[model samples]
Target chain A: MSEIIVNAVSKTWGGVGGVDRISFKAEAGTLLVLLGPSGCGKSTTLRLIAGLEEVDSGTITIGGRDVTHLSPAERRISMVFQSYALFPHLNVAENIIFGLKVRGVGRAERDEKLRKVADIVGLSHLLERKPSQLSGGQRQRVALGRAIIAEAAVCLMDEPLSNLDAKLRHEMRTEIRALQQRLGMTMVYVTHDQSEAMTMADRVILMRDGHIEQNGAPHELYNEPASDFAARFIGTPPMNIISWQDGAMLGVRPEHIFVAERNGVPATVRAVEYLGADSIILCDVKGETVSVRQTGYCSLPAGTQVGLEWQNRHIHLFDRDSGKRLADRAPA
Target chain B: MVAAVMTAAEPKTARHRNWATNVNAWLLLLPAIVLLGMFTHYPILATLYHSFFSLGRSGPAEFVGLENYRYMLDDDVFWQVLRNNFIFALATVPTSIGLALLMAVWVDKKIVGRSFLRLAFFTPTVLPMIAVANIWLFFYTPDYGLLDQFLKSLGFAGHNWLGDPSTVMTCLAVMVVWKEAGFFMIFYLAALQSIPPELKEAASVEGASRWYFFRRVTFPLLMPTTLFISINALINSFKLVDQLVIMTKGGPNNASSLLLYYIYEVAFNFWDTTYAATLTVTLITILAAVALTKFVYLDRRIHYQ
Candidate 1:
């Protein structure tokens, strides 16, 4: 019953459309990630759901209640900020129980919940330490702990792992996803990182320029992007968007493009970046930069001529003007 | 070992160079050290030395160790001035700091004419205390003054604002708070601005009321700034006697007289140098105690990152 329905919500901030008519429904006990590049209004949509921001037009409902006008506290929700936003003056234990204290939760219940949350977040020993004393990862755990302790139906996270280092981000990402599942809390996460969206989201709402480009599962967005922007944004190194005649563009994932000695489109290698697990070979095909992802070390020198081949179904066509995907693939 | 010892041994000129460096450092510090010695240390020690002596009338002075201390304890005016100073600090420091914090919060908001509001609040701080007291003197004037005229128009009688024994200290305290709160506000503004806006936003999401957020998060975070402003307000309460000189002159039974003003009166008006020196020692002790409290207690309680 904690399903959130954002109904055609639009929020214009500082003369720019923060989120324009963005509509999506996050089902109960699911992790829905609002993924997009910066300024794509993903965070704005999350804020609207939390009621931190009012919709310029349209409505938002949470847990079967029309909460478009309700303040964040009135709505049964918790949020973890990008900066963690831990109270620097309060110790870790106090920070986690702040919301409960504000709501006048009894001391016994608060302490009991605090102990359980601290054990889950691994912050039992650090209850006495202030936020300043905690490391970045530990601070992030505290933020997560604070949100989870609220026992709200929904937990909204705004790039909770972005402040951490790569290793910590990976660890926290797994921890957060696991925590969400264990608690069965409906969570709406916002981030620009596609890998995070692809790996963790039960459903990913990809946005661009204040509009939802596509809303589906991670692999659905990856395998069948709705437009050139969605196609390029959802994949690693992005889909290579090669322009064709008649205002059409061909989209292909880098991993799908296989490099052979001869048989397909002839291209010359411009550069090769060795990334241990896989090497990305940058090739120049008729002056358009095309990248090919190959397993293992690819030591081909610059100017090495190669043929790129892919299955007919792998190529995605889009209208160059509107950036919309075009069906019925034809020879480029 | 021979080579290590040979390398460790200093050259003849190296020792001379080290001595030269020491001499250069002292040369650079000479002016500052001399000024501090003559103006600060010498005066402090001299005041302590002088407090033990009796004022001489065209003759050599004699040592009167505890005589001045006993007189200070017995002098009703000195006791009244001391008590008034305590009351003045207690009345002004927290009130001004609280008002300063409120003004800072108001000005920090995106309100209309905020820059003008800030300027209006801070203008009193820029004006000389004597000029402010003179301006307020007209406002406090008994019958035809601004306050009295306003009160008369409001269907009430006007009382002597500055002349009344009961109201003199309170009037001065109010004026001092008005003149000083804005100056303290600048520090609060800087501290408040430095607090991340995201914290407030996060608090909003957590459903903390404005007052609750302020009590738990904002106020605790601003403890260092409050301590800083409190110390300044305390020191100013004792040192700022210009308005007392201009408005009340510690008159009408010495109700409004502070310690520093009384010291000035004893030293300059009565030519009791020894007594003034004793009073100066007391003022210094009070200020030193404040500085100690700040460094020892507040600093430990509020960790500044």
Candidate 2:
């Protein structure tokens, strides 16, 4: 396994910075995710570490070796693209063993590695079939097989499951986690999907506007965000950033808010979405929309008066001017 | 009971609708089928039929089975022209295709002045063949031509480019390749652009060298375009006799003459219609055979979908 250390790496295109001085360390045997919205430079950071995109200024060390100026091929890493990018002309086995053959490995060794990787990805029966004959999930497995067959210490995956259907994405996500754990591979995954970051990452670096807004574990990002942006971006139905008394912005997750009888600010229910296991209620509080997520079957009628309440510790106060968290605020 | 009654009544109306649809489809197809029959099928059959007859002067033509064929086999000029056509095809098709692929790759890459290079390469294709031949005639002129002047400046003796039998075919083949490669390059360029750029990035990340990526991924993916360009180049090689007429005129003892050019000389210049018809039949047969081999053999090996 390899520990990836990116130090103040910066890349710019035509005076517009794609990634501004960003630094993080993916510890050995940990799955680190670069999570952000589109155009937030998560993929750019992954590409920089893989040596696909040259860093304008900074040093990157993988396994303690400086690889900033090396070519992608010289870096000891493997990548799975978002599109799977399987060779259309090659069959499954050929696609998997292509890296080995190109490196001048012996045919016997290549075949042996191919079989092992195919078995791991459950693609043994499809070795002779072309990529055109495979389904979306099958093609994703082939891409994974290609990365795993190289046996690199650091594996980079750029939204590998973004092309698959929802059910298959869930299945493949779990399988990829299992595979990484079994092999002890240090992976740097890039995605805009926060759930993927939550369920798969040992550490998530949430970026915004070319800067790392917060870097911590998934639950830490969920419960304790560093800024208003992170507070609204990490969780499903996200956290509500409502103006508190004296113009302080308060951040609280939708799940933490309780529908009370008459203890707090009264709001009107705008809509209710009855998802099977969870129901989300949209409420209007002083012309600001706030969302409430509750466990199954919240059947409140529209335009009904409801009071919102939450524990004092759940309130995250932010400075109105800078959107940064207030240091002096304590739970009241 | 109601469903059974409806099903029984539906058959007659469905049959009537099917018949009406068939008639409408046939009406739409009539124009294309008729035009094709008049221009292509009729001419092919007429040429084959005329090959078996002899032209009689001042009298009705007489049937002569195999006579024209025997004469064609014995004619040295006909044999020479057929051999020359074969040589021209063998020289031009592969070289032009290779050059086209190379030029396409260079253009596809993000190089400086790429648009200008594309325009320069494709200029020869847009020029008419007769005009191109006229321009090349000046280049190949003995002693004072561009090629000879360059050679003379380099301390080498000047040689006859198109006049001598040894260098005539090679000069024509080179000119043909220069004209045709750019046209073929357009097809290759289109095919290359359709391949996702991610494949190249993945290959680079996988440690595949540029040449390895091209051989395993880019080249195989371009097979369908190559087949299409090759067929067009082959057909043009046989039919493109405009250059021969303008530059060589089948000169220096018909060294640069092609089969179609010879057929023109036989029918129009010498008034030998029967011999020309026999030669036309042979040309058609060769083209049909090539097309068949491509469909039956190459199509199986190069999967398009």
Candidate 3:
């Protein structure tokens, strides 16, 4: 079942705008992530779904009912915020139980649900502690517990792991993913970290300037980025884009290029980054710096002459004037 | 030893430079020194000297150690006045803080004709408290006041406002709330401005309705600000006695008499100089206690990220 349907939804601020007529869906129990840079409208689109912001146009359906004008309490959806938004005055149990209490859920049912959620998120030992007393990771779990106990059809998380340090973020991301699968809850997560988006999401909706550039499975987005923007945004250190003259927007993944000792190909090493697993060779092809992932080729000094080689079919081409990906390159 | 001492000294010119740095530092603190001595130290010393002594008729004051303090503890009127002051502080602090918060939320919403409405709420704060008292005095008049006229028109019997003992304090409370709520609202407004908008939006998305959001999230966050405003309202309640003077004169037989106004009467009206000195000491003590709480809280309240 499609638990959420955002149909032509758009929101524009008074001066600068956010999401522009974005439409997408999340199948029940599937995780859909709105991935983009900061100020790229990923969070705004999430806010629109949560009913925090009114859309300037379009309708949203949850559980097959039009809920565009409905208030948040009326919508059977729960959201976990980036800051966790834990009530400082309320202990963990109180915070998780707040929404249910407000909705008149009976004490026993609420308690049982709270226990289940706490157990799932591993927060049973810290029920009496306030948000201030909890560390960042603990707070994140409490926030998840808060949403989980609601038992809403869908859960929306807006950059919930950004506040944690890098190590904690990785651990919590895996924990959240496991918990989601165990519960089979429909989730829409927003984040800018490409790695987190790649690892945590079943489907990633890559956005640029308030519009969805491409959306697909993580590997699909990686192997088949629809535009230069998607290619550059989807990978670590991003895909190496070289400015080539004469109607070519050349891009290659750092690992895709090899410094083979082959003839009739042109390149020169400009700068070398000695990464233990893979060296990043910054080569000057004419005047452009081309970053190539030198796998098992670490300790290569700068100014080392190397021939650039690649499979022609794997090379991507784009229309330089429009920045649109050209599926078939013009004959070389 | 001489070489070691010379190294420690650096040079005579270096010592001169150190002296110059000291002087520059003092110069930077000059304004604070003058203001502190003028506003705090001198008055405290003068009050301390007066509190111990009995005033003689047209001569040098007599030093009767703790005599005024003992007299204060025994005076029936002084006790009554102190009780009334405490009641006033309790009544006004809560009412003012609550009303101020309501007004801040109302104005922050930018309701219809928002600028005009904001201006209306804040106008009372700009007008002098004495002037506000005068306005309320007319409103509270028994026969010809607008309130009495409105009551009669609505088929209800009109009654005295400040004239009635049961309602006099309530009248003062209402008047003070009207005068002070907007001022406190400005503080709340500043606090409200500093709250991240993301926090509220997050709440909205959490399936919590407006009231639930405020109760769970916003109210707890605004705790430190509420404490701040409570302290301000407490101090202002003791400081404002102009209404008692102009509207009630602490009368219909001293029903509305406050600690500060009563002190003024004892010192100046009765020429019971010794008794007045005693009253002044009490007033200073009460004010000092409130000021000390404010000082401590303000110094340590800020929590940085």
DockQ leader: 2
Q: Each prediction's Cα lDDT score?
A: 0.92, 0.92, 0.83
lDDT for position B151 in model 3: 92
lDDT by residue for model 2 over B223-279, one digit each (tens)?
Answer: 999999999899999999999889998877999999999999999999998889999
Show pairs that collide, candidate 3.
A254-A293, B250-B254
Off by over 4 Å in 1: B1-31, B303-305
Which residue runs of candidate 3 sit more than 4 Å off their true CA positions? A14-16, A108-111, A241-248, A262-264, A328-331, B1-52, B58-76, B83-87, B134-172, B244-248, B285-305
Kindly list the interface RMSD, in angstroms, of each predicted candidate in the order they appear.
1.2, 1.0, 3.1
Model 3: which docking level applies?
A: acceptable
Q: Order of all candidates by DockQ, from best down to worst?
A: 2, 1, 3
lDDT for B96 (candidate 1): 96
Residue lDDT tens for model 1, A97-149? 98889889999999999999999999999999989999999999999999999
What tens digits encode model 2's per-residue C-alpha lDDT throughout A130-190?
A: 9999999999999999999988999999999999999999999999999999999999999
Query: RMSDs, each prediction?
Result: 2.3, 1.7, 4.5
What TM-score fits each model? Answer: 0.95, 0.97, 0.84
Clash pairs for candidate 2: none
TM-scores computed on chain B for all candidates: 0.95, 0.95, 0.90
Clash totals in order: 0, 0, 2
